[model samples]
Target: MNGPFPAIAEASATGETADLFADIRATVGVRVVNLVWRHLATLDGALPWAWAAVKPLYLGGLPDQAAQRFRETMIVPKLASLAGDAPTSVDAVLASYDHSNTINLFALGALVAWLRDEADGGPPPPHGPRLRAPDVALPVLASEADVAPETWALVQRLNRLGDTAQPLILASMYRHLARAPAFLERVEAALAPVQADGFLDRAIAANRAAAHETAKRLAQAISAQRPPLADKIETSVSAFIDHAIAKMVTICRSIRVARGQPL
Candidate 1:
């Protein structure tokens, strides 16, 4: 699960960090803690505070509700269908991220909005049952050793989509799918137009803005009291919510939409 950006390897986490990782997986109904959370843990004092801040949103089903609303409203663009007979494992990988990222986007988005005071109202009351993650196992995120040289390069290239600015954190989705080079090859073919025509960033920005606004509405669900959070923590959280997670959510879900699959 290593990336260009620094993060605590989930397996190597110990003591409180390990405990937080476990809590995240259980509460989010996902098998693994996401890269963002793991990255946050790399910073001093960031993980514990941030997790404490956001855990209530997860418990109250605020993120679950927000994610459900988001699914209905997402403007997924059309892409050419991927041609190939990939295994069921491919679907499982995408579904795992599709479910996990959507929830994290809102859950973390709400945290960002609340911290910035972009949303009105205080914490929300409990909103019944939390949404369940799909029953799927995401492939272990691939490293260069695990994939062909060309495929590893393609994975890195795909990670740079919409990188008019400096490259953001490497997306774990591309890495996860690297185990299926042919699948990623088709993905590159399908998305090349979107990237070349400058639609990729537009689509991602629109989705991010929409999620940001929706998350602000859900901001009342944040349970943390207002105090000055660390600048580094705020900056990192904002960047991920603004960039990597949003972009991947759009791309992964768009792929599903084009394939006539349920997202």
Candidate 2:
């Protein structure tokens, strides 16, 4: 199935596009532009307009606080005890996934909330306690030619983890972590039990619902500071927010299950 927009590959980016890529990574504390931004970059004037609208919120700490608030407020199931001791590598992989998921979920959630408010013709939400973005070294997105064959195959498999009908959206998380095949393998094994038991499905649904609600509240909190977005840019940003939030749900579920959490 064809996606709505093609991702602008980092290798081919130039001038403004390349600069935008760097800014996105630096601002969001990520190594690569997540699929949402990459897809936005494909649309004429969409990426810049959308970024301008949300840059202040991201930089001013609303996103980080929103994320922390989510973690503090949401009620998630407890992690099941693993049958055997996990290796240090497994722990490392889980930590990496957690970091990436937390950052994306909050930032994307805030953006979506603001977009929703804009669409609904409401005042922007008020701000919460400001917090600095976490300092974490994110893994670089691996080029296909640079990755080992087995690892690349594993990345493809991981990307399709939750598919049943439509094509599963490929998450940047897997591609970024493709550099560590062992880590992916361990994560896959750790999640196998939850996947088989249908726990992963429940977790994904829960995360998606929670994200939507969080976005709504965040939008209300930051409504007063909402920026003016053109119709074309609004439409593009809205679509990106929808897709990105859904993907973030999947990423969150995968991270939870990988850590032996229940739905």
Candidate 3:
């Protein structure tokens, strides 16, 4: 995690934190740790407790199942077709984030539901095998100094799409994409109109609401007890779910979809 976000850098994590980070990578089957999880590591007692509660969900593939269902029902605004002309690396970057973020969105969404309300007595989540993470390697996240000034500014601009939150935190995807700024410029060109007409916001809102309920249902299978830091952890998870994860899930999918990629 970099920039203004309060997170222990993955390279800096040691001891229990480091081991838990490894478990998260192995269990999620993604090579990189996502920003939300890293951000959680900065909170005292948050990572161990939160990860313990959700580990079974990942093992059983509940979040993966939940994420697919979310995608099926989720509204993805079709952008006008000129995007996706970037390099294979750009496509790979989009593919990887599209997979990992959507999964975390649902997994953490389930955690949020379990924290806020009682799980329904409905049947357990259906058994579905989760896909292994995409093997494509993404470039390291670009710092402002690494990219041209205008490109870095565009990264900030794209990160602000569909978000009205104050003191915005950068989405990791945008930072990674900055490594390919031309692709990001294309992304901005594609999404700028979508955001203006409010199609993007509606889609983000619909998906967020749907995911909340789906995750609530998935939370039914979780038997993990509340940790002492549940309140604080819930607050952090809710923020990401409501803000970054909620918005990016749709944006990433839209980018992939417009690029003629199958999500």
Best candidate per lDDT, number?
Answer: 3
Order of models, best lDDT first: 3, 1, 2
What clash count does candidate 3 reach?
0
Model 2 C-alpha lDDT per residue in residues 13-122, reported as the tens digit of each score = 88888899899878776555667677777877777766766677776666666667666655343334332454444444444445545655655566665655532234
Predicted structure 2: lDDT: 0.59
| TM-score-best of 1 and 2 | 1
Candidate 1 vs 3: which has more lDDT? 3
Prediction RMSDs, each to the true structure: 2.3, 4.9, 1.6
lDDT (C-alpha) at residue 90 in model 3? 85
Could you say which candidate leads in TM-score?
A: 3
Q: List where candidate 3 sits over 4 angstroms from the true fold.
A: 1-4, 82-84
- Score candidate 1 by lDDT: 0.82
lDDT of each: 0.82, 0.59, 0.85
For candidate 3, lDDT tens digit of each residue in 123-143? 777868986789888888777
